[model samples]
Target: MFNDDEKPMAPASNAGRPAVGFSDAGKASVKAEHSKEAPLAASTISVLLDVSSSSSTVGRAPLDLVVVLDVSGSMRGPRLEQLKSAMQFVIKKLSPMDRLSIVTFSNKSDRPCALRAMSEAAKSDLKGIIDGLVARGGTNIEAGLETGLHVLADRQFTESRTANVLVMSDGEQNHGDARQVANPHGVPVYSLAFGADADMKLLSDLATNGGTFNPVPDSGNTGMLAVFSQLMAGLLTVIVQDLHLILSKPTSPDDDLDKIIKVAPGDFNQETDAQSGTVTVKFGDLFSGEVRKVVVDLLLVQATGSDYEADMLEVAVSYPDSKGVRQKFRGQTLHITRSGAATSVRATPNLVAENARRQHAQSIGAARELADGDDLEQARDKLVEAQNALEDVLDQANPLVAILRTELQQLLDRMESPELYKAEGKAYALAAELSHARQRFASRGDVEGVRLFATPRMDAYLKQAKEFAENPDAPVPNADEDAEEEAKANPIALVAGSLAFYIRTAVEALQAIEKIVTATAAAGNA
Candidate 1:
């Protein structure tokens, strides 16, 4: 769950774009783990590949844009200039594949502008229309949105691809209802809200249906054109459709740590419900498998949904499910020692719980291998021995036990029954049962508990795991070695060097040309 107060990594005011899954891989030197795998719907996999890889800008859907502007008596001074400027920016930034229509609303206009399709040839015409716009009437924002939708709905943009609607307003609805306009087109209407008097709540809701709510970071200081350009260019970068992940039962067939995971459809934007000191994300239809590493970037928003606040910083989350309620995931606790302080690292409640269930499923698969063994006595003994050797150790740190305690404490805080005590037991019981199903996987030397719960690519994961397993208290890599690694990884130095060389060559060429021209002129004069 993302918090509004968490400053976005890509600031709204920044004209720069966020490096989507590319530069993060250290200058695209690595092959993708998830980017290559096709999501549930193979059609929307455009984002999986690099944007530069394709000759097209096609996304999961093609959006038809209608910039419904509210121009009335109030938008007379700086507001009018900002509004027109914003439209200009939007026109320049709109991708050629996308269609742009301009509509302005005012009480004085005879008929609202009908949506016009944008093209290279039509670009001049759209500019002409914008220039011709007059501001002599009262505000009628609702009417403008209605008109925009009517024009858009007239041409079902969402038939296959997605439909996008952007509404810019500064005041409340003077006429008509924007929400009541049956969006049969499934068009996601995002809004750029302005003016202190406007209903920001409505604008935010409108954007959530797939649109983005972008308030000008600083009012009066922005050119409408500049802001519009930023929004249009920024919107295209979001390619990942479903972000929430679940690991079902991933395993290593060899001694190699394999990352097996699939993606499914779901919406996970900012999780508001997670603010109660418990971050929980509910899963819907999702692709599941074995997961090795999960990295999530949290932007410290300073304070989103508020104006002019700077009290936020980005933080990485790496903690075990703290509120330990019985969960499906039986996660391994990584004892993390950072800053000379040791703390048991655990997965988030949501991820850990889901993973526990996945591990249980893997364990069950192992039981089947145990049953097929030729030596029954050996199989039973091995299974019993493995089960007993770790039973006490596991029971002490059993995820269920910790969860029950936390859940019971929570219930006590609320003055309610600690049902999770029983519930947690059931969750673990189900996991163990799932593991128990694998009766013979152990006997044939084919099973090693639930595959998902275990480390991936046993060799790779084990190699790394053993280093940590054996020297859990050892100091990290030396500063000198780390400095050398940093020197190799730094790309900025290369960029700077290239720019310096290019300037030097340019200067040398200029001097050479000057000498040659002077010599020719001297010869001519003589």
Candidate 2:
């Protein structure tokens, strides 16, 4: 589905029409829709990155990864074993074109392996190092991070690759300033907190600052493996890095535009220049088959006279491709006509739905935070308000609305049960942890049930690979003739294939929380 030949198109010479760059690739298309109203009416213009199946693989980059593991005393038993298995899986999945490094930390940091290309020999050596690791002493996360950063920096200077860090920790930082150490690293850090005791806030902050996701696994080896597999899949399919969108202000004084806000693919960074009316938004990375949507509210004050063209806005996009090639795209002057006729046009349904989904997710997050603070009444009120708001904008048939309704109902049920509300001990702790993990996953715009849903396909691919290796003369698979077929046959071979693992893990954690809550409620009734 990915079209590597699609390029940004220049707008026509016409003055009053909206123009886009890379329209075929769906890179920077602008849609301006206005409500039918009097002279002083508002409109909304959406900027969409349509990374549909037909055009998802614009830029594929080889990965340069650094895996930072925690070998603290807390991770000594099943946690350490799970971590090792996860690392082994990652090593196996990486192609020879990719490079990897390993760093482990307890009271101090140890570099078990330097940046090495992925070969059979390298993988065997890494596996041996992982197998020999023993958990003891305290956690010094800063040392591990620093070592990983150094390894990545060294590799970056020698070769051009998409460098990243995968930090797996199950404890807090007992030495060194992790924030200070990580701030200067050029590579993104994808953190995975292994247990309930892991510092979620710290891991979240680290990943956010590094422009990546932090996923926490549930309390089990299966959960750990699921989260790690998903994270690795995401890392393997990054298409664009350090993507930035710069928007110049509208030229007409009669036009007013609200600050641009991200509606999908999770929030990143936005900056505005008040004097120049310029806005810069930083999108850390764009994966294959990922569509990013941003929305802005616009008001046009028009005079009742002859139709005239007014400049609306201009957008410029810049990012580095997988090969470390700097690519830039610019949009033509966006213009709108002012007329006396009372004609209105509706916005795109999909864009509207996306904005509504973002609002819904944000509301859920706010309500959960309030509940965590023991403000049950406020949390319920927030959820109700969110539901009402969604109903006003989204149709009942919208699947996202249904999901929001279900989540709200679940929260309501939990709040109504006094015994469940006050439940404590391991079950409560696990539920709370999973709840946070689910919220974080939603914030990242990850689809639910992806990991488990993709497992059978992944297994099938592995089985085929084993068969091919044994025979060495199997007919070439014609999977790529259709994107869906190819993904089902070999999920890791496509850009969207890797996301299945992360989504699956998030769904599993949520399911576990539900089971825990249900068991607690039944026991209380007994």
Candidate 3:
């Protein structure tokens, strides 16, 4: 665990908007040791972009959301009540500018509420519909998703908006193929695995194109609420949209065009401009405080004569500002010296960039493949190999590396037995991959590593929600609980604070029970 004093990365001076930074792992040299005629060398470089939230006078973008909720038999009892409580919180958070629709699915799927702006009256009606939901019949996830798409498709596309689909399912699909449902609008689809019976692997696959897959370990109210809170944080904090990153050689006629021959953009959608030879990666939208690392391997050709400087590559980024005007940030030119001397040269690696590269690479997928093939030992060996490399190159004390090493170790522990691997190892692997690949903090609906991107307000709400769910009747600590002298000196102030705390808790607990009672009564009526 990282100490409270430590940070994941150094704070960027450019705090408001996304800023571009560059570093090379090592320099490329032309001459090989002990030989005059040697093949050209290759080098790896990384471009790290800090996507921080801009100071906004206007609030978050207007949201067009569709929630596909599961009403299967498995979701009855506490499971459904917990879900309703979370949904209430969600409805309470949205503004009038945001539009929402609710789609419920079981043996069949239907929309209880059509897409409408979150007016006060509309919110009340939605809450009523949410409380009255009854869980029954088989799970038709395919029908749910298709109906959701139809809802979005039926809406007016005349305006620029941020749209998404939220999928909550606690059981396996028994009706049709959810994977085959096509999303013509290309809206991101965030999924939640509500309980143990959920098909995590399938949900992970569905969220691959865009969006994230969050796991809620069980039907516990706190976990459910935390997942919903995290989802809200992501939806309301998109700072950059239609982000485009372009990579190509310098345009100078004298510059060496042949220096960079290939570019591999891992898992991101890319298009190579044949005429200009520039690779453009489409990173649709970035949330507040998110970090995206673009690492590309470059092959450099060595000059025959003396040492000289050569341009490696240039990176440029573009995104639209709030006023709908395009903004561009051009990265500084990267250069390295080419040496022709017969002596061997050693290149110093940039530990930070290299570590980021390894984390984003194929280790998780490699292990998953081996484990799926029944080669459990090889899967464990693959993780060990990755961990060893990380240890060799990175300082073990670094906060980021320490956290990563700990997670890797946790995965390693699961491979000790086939029974263990079958139970939860695979889920851990998927979570780690999603966390790194998408550069978001994803886990089993726990608060671990959530502070990485969660704003202070959201963080406080999550901690409080978790604490309340764990022990609703627990007393709130006095403001000066640890400072005995201060508490004694300010007895009157302490009494006032305690009174306020109790009042808040009483109201919140009453509200929770009210929702539960309403749902229970509705179920009994059916």
Candidate 4:
């Protein structure tokens, strides 16, 4: 055997197509379709998210791996042996061109033991050092990080590719607490927690800076080794690696949905693969109220042809105001396809109907307690808990139900002060939002699904807004922002307001929502 743990003698030229994200069933379908390729590992997919919206891959290639092994007294047994075996797996998996280094700390301030290099010679030598590893001394968490950085040498990292540190530990950083001092390695570091005695926080902190932290609770060293393997293999397929996203730009939520979506820092990293070719992506993020912009970041993999495609990525964000009022905005699956993997990404944005129904009943009872209680936070707590429980059932994507979930969330935000005009207005707006969401639901035409969706309170506030706004006795609307503050909404006002909103959204989605609402009303009246 020419040393399975020997360093990769040469760098690999990534020359394959990018893979797509799909449902498990869809994935199986594709796998079966491609079963004829005997040499292909179709089951292996490398997924990279473009979280940076720049044209460069952060000026780095991808392999910045630092091995932080634990040789403390407890790890002296077969555990240490298993770790070396796992380390060997990583060595066999990585390319010679990627950066590799090792760090170990025991006792108060012991110097690190490391062999740093970007060549096969360095890795080859490190394998021997790994095999000859001996367990001694107590754990000193601070020293491990300090030595990791000393070996990494910050000044040299600017031109490195895939700069990262992999910290494997079964002990806490108990000796001293200088973790934050030398911890900012200015790159991603993945944490691997081993055994029961490992400190999750220490590993989490180490992985917090531009990296991910993973835990190996058992002695499944093979799985731990595979994590690194998957991460590296995906990196090789990427071309454009930078992306950014922002949602709901331009319009103020002061009551609007005809929003403008903008993508800031929209540039993506440049990328190309042999089979799939080059891929460029647009990244985005969504904000509440009137959407003025959407920002996105992405890692471009490859494409099969010139046809435009889109893949989906979903994001959820929320904030709680001082009065224990919660507000939120949800982004559906992000699509990134253009002769690449975009069209295959799906968003199963389904509402938890079963849970929502259960909560709806409990909420009615809770509403009684809420009205009698002065503690808004306490009241809000129950509401959030219920909503969270309902969110659990979301795995399918249906539009009508989407509206109810959004409405329920908004209702939770306003529950504390149902009498307040602002809260009431929000409720009305939410009702309108639900009305729109319902229209999308009809497109699916599943009776059982529709019945489940209709179970939620349609909260007819928008219908009331319309009647009040059109009242002959009501004064002409004031354009002043303060005027909106003084206005109190009733059923008529809600119906009129709802109509105006319906018109705006109808135009925005190019689907004529107002027409649909009008038709709905007429059919109901008939």
Q: Which candidate's lDDT is highest?
A: 3
Model 1 score (lDDT): 0.36
What does candidate 4's lDDT look like per residue over 67-91, in tens digits?
7677787788767876776665456
Model 4, position 158: C-alpha lDDT score: 33
> How well does each candidate superpose onto the true structure, as a TM-score?
0.39, 0.68, 0.74, 0.42
lDDT of each: 0.36, 0.55, 0.62, 0.39
Model 1 per-residue lDDT tens digits across residues 68-96? 77777666777776676556545543433
| Model 3: ten consecutive residues of lowest lDDT | 22-31
Candidate 2 displacement at residue 213 in angstroms: 4.8
Tens-digit per-residue lDDT, 223-260, candidate 3: 78787877766665554566777778875443433534
Off by over 4 Å in 3: 1-59, 257-259, 304-310, 323-331, 337-361, 413-419, 449-461, 467-526
Weakest ten-residue segment in model 2 by summed lDDT: 1-10
Native-referenced Cα lDDT, model 4: 0.39
- Runs of candidate 2 exceeding 4 Å displacement: 1-59, 156-160, 210-220, 249-266, 271-276, 306-311, 321-325, 332-339, 343-348, 406-526
lDDT of 2 by residue, 280-377 (tens): 76766554444445565444444455554455566656665324565665433355665456455356666676666667656766765776687878
TM-score of 1: 0.39
Top TM-score hit:
3
